[model samples]
Target: MGYIAFTIGFIVFFFVLAFLSTTFSIPADAMLPIGGLLLLVMIIAIAAYAALS
Candidate 1:
């Protein structure tokens, strides 16, 4: 349950970052790497939780 909540939080955080990136016209190269890292972290967290469960 905690892990699920954390995953949700991370997703929201990622989207917020994305929104900011777009709204502010962040450079593609920087935004892409950061976004990819965030997504990768989210995936890894979810996978870890699933494996543990």
Candidate 2:
């Protein structure tokens, strides 16, 4: 259940980012670094969650 919630939240986060980028004319080049950071955070979060569980 917790994993499912986390997955849903992560998906929603990307969707929101996508919407904002399109609406605000955020450059794709700028988004690359931001996306990489988010991916790193997601990996760390999952690792921490698994360790705690």
Score every model by TM-score: 0.55, 0.67
lDDT values of the candidates? 0.79, 0.81
Residues 1-53, candidate 1: write the lDDT tens digits. Answer: 86676768687977878797889989878887788787787777777877787
Tell me the RMSD of model 1 versus the true structure: 3.8
For model 2, the local distance difference test gives: 0.81
State each candidate's clash count: 0, 0
Q: Candidate 2, 38: how far from true, in Å?
A: 0.8
Off by over 4 Å in 2: 1-6
Residue-level lDDT of model 2, residues 11-50, one tens digit each, is 9779977986899889999888887888788778877877
Q: Which pairs of residues collide in model 2? A: none
Screening candidate 1 with a backbone cut-off below 3 angstroms (N, C-alpha, C), the clashing residue pairs are none
